[model samples]
Target: MGRNTRKRRMPLATKVTAGAAALALGGGGLVWANFYASAHEDGGHNRTKSRGAQVATINCPDVGQKLTKVPRKARRGVAKELALLDRQITDAYTRLAETRQAQAGDANYVDNAILGPLKSKRTATLDRIGININRAGGTAPRDLGRFARCQGVPVDQPGDGDGGGQNQGGGQDDGSGQDNGGGQDNGGQAQNGPVADDFINIEDVQPNSRNLPNGLAANGDGGSTGSFTTECGTNENALRNSDNVIVAPGVSNGAQHQHDYVGNQANTAFASDEDLANGETTCRNQGDRSTYFWPVLRIQDGTQDIDQGRPGGGQDGNVGKIVAPTAAELRFVGNRTSDVVAMPRALRIITGDAKAFTNGLNNANTAWSCTGFEDRQVTDKYPICPEGSSVVRTSAFQSCWDGQNIDSANHRTHVDFVEADGTCSNGFQAIPQLQVRLVYDNIPAPRIENGQVVNPFAVDSFPEQLHKPITDHNDFINFFDEDLMNQMVECINSGQDCQ
Candidate 1:
């Protein structure tokens, strides 16, 4: 079947990251509402113990997402600065998490000790980014420093926010992504995330709650209707790393999170285009050497992966036993309204935002569901599947190509989701959509009782993202040989399923 559409992007300042709502602990009557509150955008909101809450995280504008048009010559430098921006956020969050008591004791502590310094660092970074662009003969983004100031978000336990945090009997994310994506008053061990409120029982989610992503429709009106499947082993060799060749090509630990890999064996922070073209493949079809990967999902049961002490693992707030997906299905299907075109070799597509927890749902494409409840999926809350059912993560990549560049400054402008009516917009061409489905059978369902959670499963994420399901994402780079690319286009155009 043709793949369903998923995800998009937006401006950074207006977004509110996920966090538990402020709830007064009964009798004690004090809890911290840590997500960025709507009313506190101008300056950080400080709630005293008597006010029933305190701030929990620092929210900042995502500078990288705003640079959609950097010159190609300056992309590498801009990307590095963007990665540094991310690093600055991580450091500030580390401080925020470490100084909770200090935050409570002094109203100015967060703004002075954390957010203020963060703004200074960001200003310098943004200036460097602008310099990089200008030196490359491209106009630098204006007012880049305006995004520097960060806000301290507060969290509520259960019984906070709208709908009082999805019914505890089971939870519902609504998939609209309009509310605070499940709050986290108390972060998990290492103080990074996946608290009790992040999980919702699959049974409680209303069936078919997930709408068609961006209103993408199956082939209709001359659209290519066939499918192509690639047999890429599920990273059995444990090819995992914390670098993103597409986004942060030369920086080690660029992603600040570990990702499981399949398809291209030569993927790394330093892998050049030529290196990838000559790389070995894990796919059954040697003609297809595309790299496909996603964040490693880990079960927080006190065990740790090998990277537990490394940069992208325990050190970055991601802990737990790494759960390899039992099956990783990589499939490509035709567009919804036009005959598909062969994707240019080296085409890179990032379907979701790993920073969506703080960057907002505009680019959150991660879908969580159980095997039996395929019709019900969520963008924010993780699903607590019942026994006999396995967990599933699905990413449907962008299907429209700009027809000119293989990549863009921000890495997103080159491709886009189909319009609401199922057609590519702004002269973008329709290309085969890559859909990846990962299934895990060993993840034990988490138990939440009285607002406390037992073992929970979460995808590895940047330290500040809080490990929310919305931050889940996938990446792909096309390296198919010319003949194979042609065959794929032919197969889809001819309405024939091919392997």
Candidate 2:
């Protein structure tokens, strides 16, 4: 049986709420609402408590056993390192509290500079502790306990035998001075301390560099310039899965956060490349069924904060949640002299690297700015929004395609951006450029934390740990309906401004 001939289970249509209303067919349609609240109240999804609800403690199981098993000669060094690690963990907690207190008024600053570095420092320390422990011929424990005391709890618990505070569930201390079980420990509540095998060691992967011929200047022919816009409803089933076939597809544990998807109603973590190519679409024009996705931007909202502290922290907080943007602005920019060719089916393109968040640079296409303050562009770092303004994330994909290869080995080599002269490079065909602008409605009333105003808006990545708010990444799959795509091509080639 052929692939399309086989009967396939149709994916369920996503349930929409005030946050994600039906896609309005028009230019710049906006939908603003409390996405978190709407999902919890109307979407039947259970929301987790903010990290503040969880208590922090330092408890490692089998420490005694592991210590005893170590060789006598190396025991002393291991013991010394372990003690140092304990102190370092405590210090990390102290620093975190102090930073939070200092930057409570500026949540964006806290996440961008203060919290992320602190988490990385703690992770490095943990990695050292694990190395020393392993060197002593002992295996390290998985749950090392929280690194700091919970709010309202004393830093030093007097009655607690292990020196750590009471566990979230109020479980009795397990002789080891750590609560063995009870209330769920919010992953973001404590730092995991980096392990030796942590995934951070992987280097940023880039597409093979290609030298292409430059195409004609954008308006060299003096043809009038034109553009078109497509608006689609955001999917609420935003999930973080390791199933990326574009970058590091062989690695199943890619860390990610919630992604807001448009176009194919069935687009999801489990959706395969073939599925997207063949799936039904939710776009206004039935023929324009290409899948578009990007990380969902979320606001702190006071009730819950962003977490990206744990090793798998990417999936820790706000997993399976969706924060719909006011509207997804899809505009095509191209030469007025030439009509754009319909995007080939199953063509995969990735703009901005998610892993680049750690280094804070490398990807140049990612851009951030305040909605009204477009002149001020921010990269890698988030800009503070004035009382009246909101945060905006803008991503532009490469517009030149090889016209032959649907995909490249690096997932980007097949595509290139138009030159300053507006011509395709290396014989690559110039297509209508797709630019996405996502606007986040700032919290009407900023939450007061420690007597300071905390901006609620945050990018979907690990804000507290990664620190790179500009790691704004986006993905696109062209499964456009043949006729609609042709219309878009006609509009662009004819130099007609289209809606």
Candidate 3:
């Protein structure tokens, strides 16, 4: 848990307080679960749609010795800011590697756990970088700002020669042969297109089926509400649960739902041209008139490691019991409710397979009886179970059942990845007052030198580690086009440059 230190530079007044501090507003506020709007609403999703099916290129910005010789016109103040930003980026990489290493031993790490920390660090770095850009008299890095509101920000610059996009390049190979740690500067101009065509309308999906409550069955207990305490605490405190835990609805059988939530209730998700595009969103529900802030709530599990995630006899057929702990396992465990913990349920067609949905979510899930964080057992006061025992995450993000990468034409309305930096404009400003959709993209398929796609599953397949694409959107249809389709095929055939 890294703490932020606001260094005392020149007089606070000396810091540029010009139009919009260029910092992403909304310091630390909780957003509802309709997290898909932020990215899709602004330029991120616009980029996806305007490209019209072009392969997404992942690029790292230039960070070589170029910094050693700061631009002659670059302000001295801006220079220092850039230097600080540089160190922060390096630190982010280190932290990301550490998180990955911690989970390296776990077989069930395929859910992009390692990337979680990386994303957080990336967001922070993006924020700092955006500030530097504004201080340097540069226009905002439009992409960064859009991401901050939704998916979070990105650090590296656009990829080299990939049409104004960042390339994931590390610096030169030393004599000893270590790749120096700077990104390359391609200096390519960002692609320009008709600005009017950048976005898709999300209103068409109003009363989206994803909003219905299937994970929390109707027969179950009603959902509960509460607040978390990441606000008044240190970094360490922010790492664990500081709120009340919620139990799964009684009708849920303490498991995740397998099929779509409300999609079948009515086919509101795919009614118009605007509904079929791509976009990005953070976890704020603008569509529903609810009071919930976050889409998911995760109560920490104190146990270090639990037995391989296999449940025993229970009302669901397994006898609930506890197990041991592992070093990688964090603290707290709990459940969720439709009113509070809302995530876009992957399935939309009900097809009367309720049993299939339930079983799929609870598969091999263990209980919270064995090891409890602080020896605390699961209770109504804290809907989460103790570590090593029967446990559930109180939020949608933490639930095993909440995650599925379904992007068929019907499922993927709009989706985009938002970086946390303030460079990109916020979706709120772009679309103002609308419901949004969000999704995460798994690592693209591996590739050959010629940039052809390789089988992701064949490359590496661990149920816990299986990767899939997660796209976010307000208007879902903005992402498709001949360019994008061709690029997607190219990316799958050759993962080299595609994200």
Candidate 4:
């Protein structure tokens, strides 16, 4: 929904490798292994046992040399580190390739399944891993390196808008003291370069959405939503800003109006033409990266207004929203903030209390809210569930669409449409028309003050905000912002699905 948040202070020379595998505690096994080999004296460090004997020398392919003149001990250590770094990079590269291939393998797989959301996750993981790899002294593939050079990719900061930041005009200081020069400074110019997304692995996902058939009407976009447009180009005019629209705790409002000006205007200030176009590429590419690991929005049910506690007719539809655990709330309730805390534990804390989510928006104390809409009647005299409210019969809708819960092994049992007239079926046009809200990595955050992206580490403000993002269409046109760098920063800070 916003800009990238993956940029860090690390230089291009110092890289770090991270992946979905890394997202798992086990993935960090390598990081620990490397640290162990580099740490403490006993078994951790310098041993006469010598991996040197195990270290095989190889000729440098690019610079045809035997490459064995360094100190034996140092050489061995470097080799070991290089080998580890190579494996990490190669593994990540393989995963990224597989993800991209899988994305193209089957349109249905990409659309109905996890392509959009997982792609974003994969991208983020890749970016992290790249950072790690660089840190570990690895270099980008020569081809990528050359591309960055030719394109003059900007340095990792503003003004260095080139591919690698060697093109800052005369290296003039802007007085902000920020190093904003490097590559071509297209600060105001339009850039039509190659699209770069976060690294993500397709094979490491848990299948979190309903993988329904593509032809279903419920899954198709209604013309009313309009054709998708990129953040770049003349097509950006179609973007819808979905900021601060609240979902009543228990009622399913039909898909709200996707107006051009409905979202927070503060974010719009950073709208540079290049940022818009490039940001579209970043958003769509990252969105695609996220789908392999998570679910993307296939269809958006139009919105309906809540009439008191009762749902309006034609508007009373079943709606679903992807709810994620906020990092802040977890920090408050959880004993430890380490990644060692399993997903189940995090899920427990996030969903364990409704008050945490509802009240998180405001500093003021609000009532604990647990109101989900269901298609059944309840007796008023019965004691109400405090965390959640009972569904009222009058509040139900007539036609409804439901998402396929691909995460569930028994997806066939629950993923289908229902008639509003109280009938169970899988076909479209069922009486209980349902509205499904696909969870994209797009988190709803206030706009950045200078149109610049926020630091990933600075999201401490609202840790309870869940970042499971979904992309209705993994096309650049669907993104709301411009500024690929900014978009990347946003994704990183919010910890949502991004590449």
Q: What's the TM-score of every candidate structure?
A: 0.86, 0.52, 0.17, 0.17
The order by descending lDDT is 1, 2, 3, 4
lDDT of each: 0.73, 0.44, 0.20, 0.19
> Positional deviation of 344 in candidate 3, in angstroms?
16
Worst 10 residues of 2 by lDDT: 1-10
Residue-pair clashes per candidate = 15, 13, 136, 117
Q: Determine the C-alpha RMSD for candidate 4 after optimal superposition of all C-alphas.
A: 27.7
lDDT string for model 2 (1-499, tens) is 0001111111001111111101111111111101111111111111222322221221111122122234434434544443333334344434443443344445354344534554465556556556765776667545433331112111122222321222221223446543322111222221211101111101121122111112212434543356667866545444334234343333332233555677776655455667776777767767767778776655443244233343222333332123577656877666634556778877877776553322212332455665566644444335555667766677777777889977653355577766555656578787767787877663342332221223334455532222234356788878876777777778877777676
Best candidate, TM-score: 1
Candidate 2 total steric clashes: 13
Question: Which predicted model would earn the best lDDT?
Answer: 1
The lDDT, on a scale of 0 to 1, for candidate 2 is 0.44
Tens-place lDDT per residue, model 3, 25-111, is: 111111110011111111122122211111112112212111222222332333333333333333333233234334335433312
RMSD (Cα, Å) of model 1: 6.4
By the lDDT metric, which is better: model 2 or model 4? 2
Which model is ahead, 2 or 3, in terms of TM-score? 2
Using lDDT as the measure, name the better of candidate 1 and candidate 2.
1
